[model samples]
Target chain A: MKIREVTLSTTPNAEAVADLRLGDIIYLDGLIYTAREGVYMRALEQKANIPMELPSQSAANFHCSPAAVIREDGSFDLGAVTATASFRFAKWLPEWMAKTGARLIIGKGGMSSKDYNEYFVPNGAVYLSTVGYGTGALLGRGVETVEAVHWHEELGIAQAMWVIRARRMGPFIVASNLQGECLFERENAKISENLDRVYEGTKPAVLKRYGETDDRSDEVIG
Target chain B: MISLDLIQTTAETLMDKAAIEIPQDYLDGLRAAAATEDGDLSSFVLQAMLENYEAAKEDRRAMCGDTGVPRWFVKMGNDARVEGGFVALEAALRRATANATTGVPLRPNRVHPLWRTDHNNNVGIGAPEIEYGFEPEGEWMDLITVHKGGLFGTDYRMLFPSDGIEGIKRFYLDSLVAFGKRGLACQPAIIGIGLGGSKDTCMVLGKRASVLRTVGSRNSDPKIAAMEDEFKELGNSIGMGAMGFVGKNMVIDCNIEVGYCHTGGMQMSVHAFCLSSRRAVARIFPDGRVEHRTDPNWFTDYQRRETIEWDPAREAAE
Candidate 1:
């Protein structure tokens, strides 16, 4: 519930982020790297070195594709920046968290509980989910500079590795914390239970509303 | 005759408007949802989203980082004459897309899938995809462009005739549960359900429902409209909240579009659009009068929802 401001480097320990609880908003200040499917897949395949020295503690890799216009002077206009979903990167989360020392992986759409329990919880990391539509808010964090360290040509500006200096950059929720607790999963569990009960309670009303009474077995619902 | 230059100019205007402005209907829907939302945090999140939208307008920047793939729905006049014909119309849109990548300052999202080549511009093979609906007698073109951002999760299923209505509802609920987690798929989601069609038709219909249709619209068939109402109530009961938290509202609306399928089997596609729900539409008359609209009115016959309260004990007794 409280806003916690934390500074992260590319070499801090994951224990720095372990105590952050789910749903707590945090403002991240430091060097945060950006990557997506291509860079991460290529890194795993070639065993190539990642682009930045990320903080081991609050080491965050945002699944973002920034709408940045690089000026002739090599400065970025820093237009829109939003999180890409993490579902596609499901299988690689464990390796990504371990290898990159990314104790905090920020993106939308929660990751699988398996990945959370196996990798994030045990590794002292958390998966934070921010609003994917909050491009202006994300850009409001004050991006000082952008340096593309790797994979620019392959993935273009959107999917390449860009080391960015962000000041008070994030207002993201701890979607899944280090203790294997996930806010999304917990909420979904409640919803799922509610769904069953609601379905049972509402089926007759629904059928009647659609004019598909039990006696009229041949009538299609829609 | 509509000149190629006009087409090009109109396309440019459409792209910019679509990128820069969140439609009035969508804004109104968000405000209503926020006001009605019972969850404290979720309501705050909705308000914050509204603020984010205003910020986007003030900054003249994209509302979201992902501009998404552009989905164009064009309804052309039957007797309309064009200087360069249909091909020219498509080319103009493509050029507009390319220019808008930097002009609207859209993030270059279209890429060569196989070679992993970034186009720099959003135009590429099958990029900025367009769908056409022609009128028998008219002199204007109604163009509606919707952004298919990343937050809308994709779904498709093949069902035997046996699957029926219960099966369809089950598939929909399951998909919602899977994609609507952690605000990942983005909630107060607007779902588009396409049923009883070929695979592609179902998919397109689903996408149309998700993006093209207005939030408060419904199907003409009373049965289908009733189904929409039920899904909306059931989806809200799940309590996915604003950003996948525990709350009262999950989906603000559900639009179902159905097509007749062969006797053997049926294909269904479910597409979910996030709360942003970005779209803009422009219509050009014969005399060269261009009217831009926030609502495309994709659903021709929109039936309003009846006011009703949830009754648990009545259902429990039944």
Candidate 2:
């Protein structure tokens, strides 16, 4: 069970992304930018100009908000970079990917296989899930510097687009690959095999909530 | 009287400690889990988290990027008094929260629900919620700060008495499996269950059980304590580990906190304290002496008193 670990550039090439297998650990170098809901809405819906030159400046779109601040002297102090759940951002990914030419979608949880097949595979993008649901300090150590922050005034710190220069940043798992296979789903299928045995003695609640599913195999997320 | 300056400064320190330090009890529980975790991916995650804890301490940075929502649980002895009263005490806590937001560089996570305004200081209306408790005696106050992740790994259900213990087990499993997938709930967490209180109190009890109580600590009730042990084993048997990978460790420990509810209904809530499990505590004496520790020691006998009167001597004698 020795897991293969690889180092990747933020602006990864097609062969690099295609070569990534599900479950391989990744360490990224080069530039990475934080972009979640705020950045999505502003760039996709509001038609606002993207602050950084995408794909050229960096192709890695990180779904994160670093524990960070701007000092009175207007310098940045960033710590513990971690990812948010990526499933919630599915709606805007296709458009964002096409527009930004992003090759890496890094975040907390991996997207569904359908999401991978639909746009991620077609766009030559793969999902990288942050290990430990975080390893914020370890990830923070990889940050060479906080290059810049965008939309702090309009979007606030949590949703601001933080551009960071990463030296060897990560411990991200290749949760999805060019083949549209999801590591999480593969693991989920294996775990679900024993659910009934673990739940043998338990009985369903007398009063069930609406829309509740007794299917242990089904994911809570879409 | 506990000086306002001391309270604020201690609170600021607690915030930093809570953010950066993995409480010892939780760290121990996690280490135990890591030892038994067989799944390769899951075991890797556990090891990385262990190293991350040391990195956070050495660098004085948050252990996790999502620092969670910071809140306070204030406990004071009946004889204890603050220098400027409770209003000023609250102001001091708020000031500390805002200061730490910048000082520790915590993400200013608070915002208006509808308007989505960020003060960039983790402070806003009803932000950094301050809940209070009073002990029967002593002239000291305890400040406990917990920075729990805001989203995922918590749920509430209304079950009638007829639902029985089997029903309770079902819902508990439901919560764990639901959030445990893809490590959304941050498995190997301290799972907290609240049973039999009003809906709000049930939520509060569950939350307190998860964040306030230390790992490996149990309920005062022997019967409930047994259930806690059973639930811990039950959770780990789920064949799921960190990030929903197949593994042997899903729960580090399980804690159940109960409150009396209506005769006809049983309200239940479940909460997970997450991988980082950030919490810090300090007890300040009226003499200006302050003590810092990891354990909150919140669920004392007085907190779970069953009778109408506060008579610790009689209870002890019994």
Q: What digit string (tens of lDDT, one per residue) describes model 2 on residues A97-208?
A: 9999999999987899999999999999999999997799999999999999999889999999999999999899999999999999999999999999988988999887
Give DockQ for candidates 1 onward, in order: 0.29, 0.88
For candidate 1, the iRMS in Å is 6.1
In candidate 1, the residue pairs with backbone N, CA or C atoms under 3 Å apart (3 or more residues apart, or in different chains) clash, namely A9-A55, A10-A53, A10-A54, A10-A55, A11-A55, A12-A56, A12-A57, A109-B184
Residue-wise C-alpha lDDT for candidate 2, range B1-318, written one tens digit per residue: 899999999999999999999999999999999998889999999999999999999999999999989999999999999999999999999999999999987878888999999999999999999999989999999999999997899999999999899999999999999999999997789999999899999999999999999998989888999999999999999999998999999899999999999999999999999998989999999899999999999999999988789899876665
User: Which TM-score value belongs to model 2?
Assistant: 0.99
lDDT of 2 at A198: 86
Q: What TM-score between 0 and 1 does chain B of candidate 1 receive?
A: 0.90
Q: Over the stretch B139-235, how does candidate 1's per-residue lDDT look in tens digits?
A: 7888787776753457887776666677677677656756665565667768889887799888988888878787888777778889999888878
- State the lDDT of candidate 1 residue by residue for A47-106, as single tens digits: 777755555323778877776555457656666677877777866767887776677787
Q: Each prediction's TM-score against the native?
A: 0.84, 0.99
The positional error of residue B38 in candidate 2, measured at the CA in angstroms, is 0.8
Looking at model 2, residue B284 earns an lDDT score of 98
